[model samples]
Target: MSAAEFSYKLRVYIEDTDAGGIVYYVNYLKFMERARTEFMRELGYGKDAIFNHGLMFVVRDMAVRYLRPAQLDDLLEATVRLIDLGGASMTLAQEVRRGAEVLATATVTVACVERAGVRPQRLPRDMTDSLRAARDTNGN
Candidate 1:
């Protein structure tokens, strides 16, 4: 497991909040997803590159805990880390925070799947190697 973490920050908009102006619980997962995507992009294997290799990543499992509420216009930071890397799957630990306050945390397992049938598949060697490089570059 690598200790490297990537952080993405964004402001909650009115559309991201409930009628009461609190962020919807499920939206935290969306924010985590965006952070994961950007982490992959920063690794140089963006969506297009993954698809070109005949594979895509899909969430196979997730466990999330919500600790607090975030209101509209709150600046939220989502941090993502690769906790486990495998031939066919990657497990990520993510946290959503507002300044020093931790609002949500999750552990997500993502599996490599065939782009056509969406069936489980081994991750490309290049991707695995690149992820290792990315981890090292981030000072893991």
Candidate 2:
């Protein structure tokens, strides 16, 4: 798939922060996860479709870089772009930004697997087609 970008907006709340009032390091991953979910949802892969098909996507590998801290009540935008697609896996580039300032970035690889056995499986044809068709003119 081409680099099709998608974004999801979120607000940092107390529950997402540490005692120091900054977002916890792992919470950035959570933000990126939400962005990916939204991206798939827009591609017609909602909770039901994902969980009911006997297959689901699971993160296989991830690398994250935290650049800045986000404070409580900060409005953040999490972005996802498909950078690579394979028969059974896909890699995404993700970022969490506060307005124009990027706070974190990640490269995530996810694989499709059977829900019961968790064994890797090829991506569904329709899902791959939808991902290839996805586009965002305003993702910038």
Candidate 3:
């Protein structure tokens, strides 16, 4: 990652909106999740790889604010940035923007846990280092 490492962009689809044509509030979380997945993919680790290690990522907490509304077919961009990474948990700052207008913002905390009992576990050292490097390089 670098100072310019912004998250990926994803266009909104009709299916992502509500009957009134505005994006459904819950879908913002979906967008954020996708951005996080892509962020990990860019780091050479996919969901399967993480799960194969008997580890799974779960949303521990989140705070979201909706500032504007997005309609179906809008080209929405979702950005995800690491805020903090601890031994077993990490926090992210995520946003959904339509061009210059920020539609929504969220701070999400995720924890690494064993898939079975959902017990918290330390993230792999290499993975943790990689996330830290991304955060550092991205100036997040």
- Give per-model TM-scores: 0.94, 0.93, 0.92
List all candidate RMSDs to the true structure: 1.5, 1.9, 2.3
Per-model C-alpha lDDT, please? 0.90, 0.90, 0.87
Candidate 1 per-residue lDDT over residues 1-140, each given as its tens digit? 44678899999999899999999998999999999999999888888998899998889999999999999999999998888889899998999999999999999999999989998899888889877776656552
Residue pairs in clash, model 3: none
lDDT of 2 by residue, 1-140 (tens): 33657889999999999999999999999999999999999888998998878888999999999999999999999999888889999889999999999999999999999999999999989988887666434343
- Estimate the TM-score for candidate 2: 0.93
Number of backbone collisions per candidate = 0, 0, 0
Give Cα distance to truth, residue 23, candidate 2, Å.
Answer: 0.2
Colliding residue pairs in candidate 2: none
Q: What order do candidates take by TM-score, descending?
A: 1, 2, 3
